[model samples]
Structures are given as C-alpha cells and as structure tokens.
Target: MAGDVRAASMTARAFVEDYLLWTRGQRAPSRIAGASGDVRRELVALRLRPSRGTRRGRPQITELRTDLTSPTAGRATARVIDRVLGAQYTLRLDLARGTDGWEVTDVSA
Candidate 1:
C-alpha cells in the first residue's frame, strides 16, 4: 500500500527496476551464463499479468514495493499482494514480528 506503484508511469518504472536488479545480481549472486533468463525468472516471480486478448507478443513486468498492510500486522504468515497497472502481483516478501518494527525477513521477485 505504501510503496506499491499504481499508475502507468509507476508500473513502467517498476518494470525497469526489476530488469535492472536481476541483471545486476546475475553474475555476482547466481554466477550463471544467462543473465537475461534470470531477469525473466525474476519477472515471473512478481506474478506479472497483461491484459486479456492484448496479444502476448511481449512480456510486461513490474517491480512492486509495499509494506505490511494494517490488517496483516499480526499474522504469523501471509502473502502480500500489490496491484500494478490493474494486475495483482505477489511481492514474495516475508514479514516477521519484531520488537521495534516489522522487518522484512525474506524477499524474492
């Protein structure tokens, strides 16, 4: 809610962010040959979706950011969903109940 991108420009920006992040981590973290493929996997993990009947000629992806919703503050486990350009994408970020604040335990995509 607080960090998600909702508008078209925001979506486009997020898409660029994910692509860049994936490419950046490819060589250092993955140590694989295909950095572009890593980018694809990262995009898919974001649960990107395009318009129906819009011709899936090209892929559309967005890198979303969101904090734990007020309602989900106390849950032991929960999946956070961020709406981007009208499509819902799961953030894959795990939150833990901390002493000071809710900290992100893990995140991918």
Candidate 2:
C-alpha cells in the first residue's frame, strides 16, 4: 500500500518534469512519455505552438508535491511550481495507474 503510493508519486513527479520540459521545447512531443488520455491529446494539439527560445534556457522545477487521493483506485494529483525566465507557473496534474503503470490523465494551469 505504502509502496504503491510512493510509486504513484514518483510517476507523477517524473511526468510533471517531462511536461515542463516539453512546454519549453527541451523535450520532443514523443518524449512526453508518461502522458495518456486527454493529456496526450492536449500535447498533440500544442505541437503547433512555437517552442521557447534558447535564450531563456530550460524551465526549472522549483517545487513538486503529489498527493494520492485513492491508493486503492490508483489515482493521484500533483501540484508543481516551475520557474521559466524568472516567472513562476503553477500547474496541477491528475494521474492514474493503469496496467502499464502510472500515466498523466489531465493537466491544468
């Protein structure tokens, strides 16, 4: 039970980090690997947006916190604070554990 929660948290953290990178264009769309469902479609739609210029550099993940809302149901949510060119952005992510492992189901800013 505890192990499951830890795993889910880790999965969510990794996904959030990848998502931040993807948004900054440091990572390719195909590389946002832990996303699925609506979140995946959102990423596809965002492909047309221009990536951030290299002058700004990559975004830094300043803080990340994950809460397991339902361990038995394999559901979790994460709050992330990231810095981009000195600006901070807060994002919320919903995750679910499927047969393959944990995957991000939705994201909101």
Candidate 3:
C-alpha cells in the first residue's frame, strides 16, 4: 500500500510538471500522456492553454504535495505550488488509478 501511494504521488507530480511545461509552450501536449479526457477538458475550461505567440520559459516548481486519503481507494489528490514570472500559483489535481497506471482526472487552480 505504501508503494502504491508513492507511485500515485510520483505520477501526480510528473503530471503537474509536464502540464506546466505544456502551458509555457516548453513541451508538447503529448507530454501529459496519462491525463484523462476530463482533465483535458478541465484545462480548456480553465483557459490554461499554451502560449501562442512568444514561447514562454519553464516555470519553477517550488513545492509539490500529494494526499492519498485511502491508499486502497485508487484515488489521490496533488497540490502544486509553482512560480512563474515571479508570481506563484497553486494548482490542484485529482488522480485515479487506471489500467495503464494513474491518470489525472481533474484540475483546478
């Protein structure tokens, strides 16, 4: 169970990192490979798409934390604190265990 939680945490962290990069145009959407359709839609709804004209630089991930209320429940939440252009933002991501691994199901800021 500990290992499962750790894996889920890692997955959540990686997803956040990749998603931030994608937002900055530093990475492609494919970088967020394990995200669910709902997660993608949430990004669109949040207007967190990549920059269009000038490519933005990478954001720094200052803090990342994951919470698994129930290891066996196959669901987890990740909170990420990132710094971009000297401003900080908090993002919350919900994840669920899938057949291929953990997939991000939702996102909010």
Candidate 4:
C-alpha cells in the first residue's frame, strides 16, 4: 500500500513534468497550446527550448514534503529548481487516497 502511494506520487510528479515541458516549447505546438494558465505562464517564462542542451532535464523535482492534513486527507508540496531554465518554483498538491490512486485535486507552482 505504501509502495502504491509512492508510485502514484511519482506518476503525478511525471504528469507535472510533462505539463511543464509542454509549456516551455520543448514539446510540440499542439501539446504546448493545451496548457492552462499556470502551465502556459511557466512555459513562456521558462524558455526551455532555448536551453535544451543542458545536462539536467527541465524543472527537476528536487524536494518534496508530504503532509497528512487529516486521517483521510494528505498533501505533498515540492520545490522544483531548474538549474538551466525555469525560475525557482514550488509545486503544491492537495492529495487524497482514492479508490484507484492518489488523486491530485490541486496543483500550483
């Protein structure tokens, strides 16, 4: 069960990474245009496509801390510092144990 939770956390993290990459113009145009306001803003500012030759990947998730706000409510907030492109940012997640997986209801950076 713990492993499942961690895996879900990691998957959610990956989804965020994809969204960021799409925003930064590193991905295709269609994908880029799909981002919401927050993702688009980061993408425009991150300018990742210009710095794509760096060693580390984009928006690396460097730190993550979890808080169980209630017995059935949990959250994880992360600090993603992009060494090559993006500004120092924080990713917050309002997590809950769901029937299928950990559902991230809120995400912001």
lDDT of each: 0.36, 0.68, 0.66, 0.59
Off by over 4 Å in 1: 1-23, 26-90
Ranking by lDDT: 2, 3, 4, 1
Q: Which candidate, 1 or 3, has the higher lDDT?
A: 3
Model 2 pairs whose backbones collide: none
What digit string (tens of lDDT, one per residue) describes model 3 on residues 53-107?
4344656666666666564334444444443455567777777776877777876
Among all windows of 10 consecutive residues in model 3, the one with the lowest summed lDDT is: 72-81
Better of 1 and 4 by TM-score: 4
lDDT: worst 10-residue window of model 2? 75-84
**lDDT (Cα, tens digit) per residue for candidate 1, span 1-109:** 3432122224333333343334333223233221233444554565534444332222244333444445333112222223333444443444433344343334444
Q: Which lDDT tens digits does candidate 4 get at residues 1-109? A: 5665575566456556665566455564235321334544554565555444543456677777766666545677778887666568887766665565555655676
TM-score of each: 0.24, 0.76, 0.72, 0.55
lDDT for model 3: 0.66
Clashing pairs in 1: none
What TM-score would candidate 1 get against the native?
0.24
Looking at candidate 4, the ten consecutive residues that score lowest on lDDT are: 28-37
